[model samples]
Target: MKSFRRHTESHRTDSIGWLRAAVLGANDGIVSTASLLVGVAAAGASPGTLLVTGVAGLVAGAMSMAAGEYVSVYSQADTEAADLSRERSELEADPVAETRELTAIYVGRGLEPALAQQVATQLMAHDALGAHARDELGISEAFTAKPVQAALASAASFAVGAALPLGIAWLAPAASLMVWVGLTSLLFLALLGAVAARVGGASMAVGAWRVTFWGALAMVITAGVGRLFGAVV
Candidate 1:
């Protein structure tokens, strides 16, 4: 008889960077585009004008998200590179000090001093820079910055999210466009939040409520402002 083995899998923390960018981009796209549509519609703008505004917002928001994500992630990458360079210099100048530093860190993390020294020595022998980078500098390949990936994910997700409200605005009757867009946008926000929370292993209800509340507030505020300005003008 052949023996079978079970493999255990765990959540991937590496997804944190891209997931955060995507979620933020999508949420902003939905809220901003929907709010813009509602605001314009409330101001008695024609259906064609409202649709045009939404389409413009979708395109602008996607571009903004991509550029912002790329810049921010690239900054992080630069910082990490600088830190690694400094660490390499320190290691080259005084390898003994570097080993002691690693040993001290392990000891601080609840290891016996002797065991910590042993572990550090072995780890440094295997891969000095890697061990120090992870243990001392708190940097790892899993969390490394990938600007291109982040930018693409953000732009793509933003476009997809923005399309939902735009589609509703285009199809709904002019008189009822505001209501349809508002309600459907909130629903989309709730779903996005719930799904994001689930994927991140968080409380789905909290995520859903948090996003829905903020989205509602944004639309209400925009609509009120538009109405006030329309009346005044």
Candidate 2:
């Protein structure tokens, strides 16, 4: 049972890597692009201008998402590498201290001191680096941070999310484009929220309605502002 459970957790750990960023990136793309379209449409822009704006938003947003993810993940990777190097040095210079350190970690985790020391001894015997990496440095292959992959995944997801609003704009009547875009985009936001919650092991209904409410409110406020400006002008 323990072995089986470990295997399941191992896989779950890997999925958490890209899955979190992908979902978030997609969510940003959807919300931002949708909001942008709603705002522009509310401004009573021409269909041609709206289409141009939507396309531009998609491209620019995707690039921005990808670049931002890459830079942020790169920093994490650098920090991990530095920590790993420090661990390696400590292991080489003072193996005894490192060993005691591992024992202390186990003790902190609720193990008896004698038992913790014993466990550390056994694990170090099998793989010293592995023991420290898991118990001290807190690094794992399953949870490795890959900057390039993260960046690409984020950008791709953002593009997918941004595309929804753009597609809505294309099909909508120019005269009523704002209304259709708002409604359709809100639907997408709700769906995205539910799906994200399901993937992240959260409450589906709450997630759906939360996103729906915020998205609707944003659209409404933007529309009102646009109408006010139009009336005043």
Each model's lDDT comes to 0.93, 0.85
Tell me each candidate's TM-score: 0.94, 0.89
Evaluated against the true structure, the overall lDDT of model 2 is 0.85
Cα lDDT, model 1, residue 191? 99
* 127-203: candidate 2 lDDT, tens digit per residue: 88888988887888877789998998899999999999899999988888887888888889889889878877789
Tens digit of per-residue lDDT, candidate 1, span 1-233: 99878745556586887898899989998999999999988888999899889999999999999999999999999999999999999989999999999999999999999999999999989899999999998998778999999999999999999999999999999989999999999999999999999999899999999999999999999999989887887
lDDT of 1: 0.93
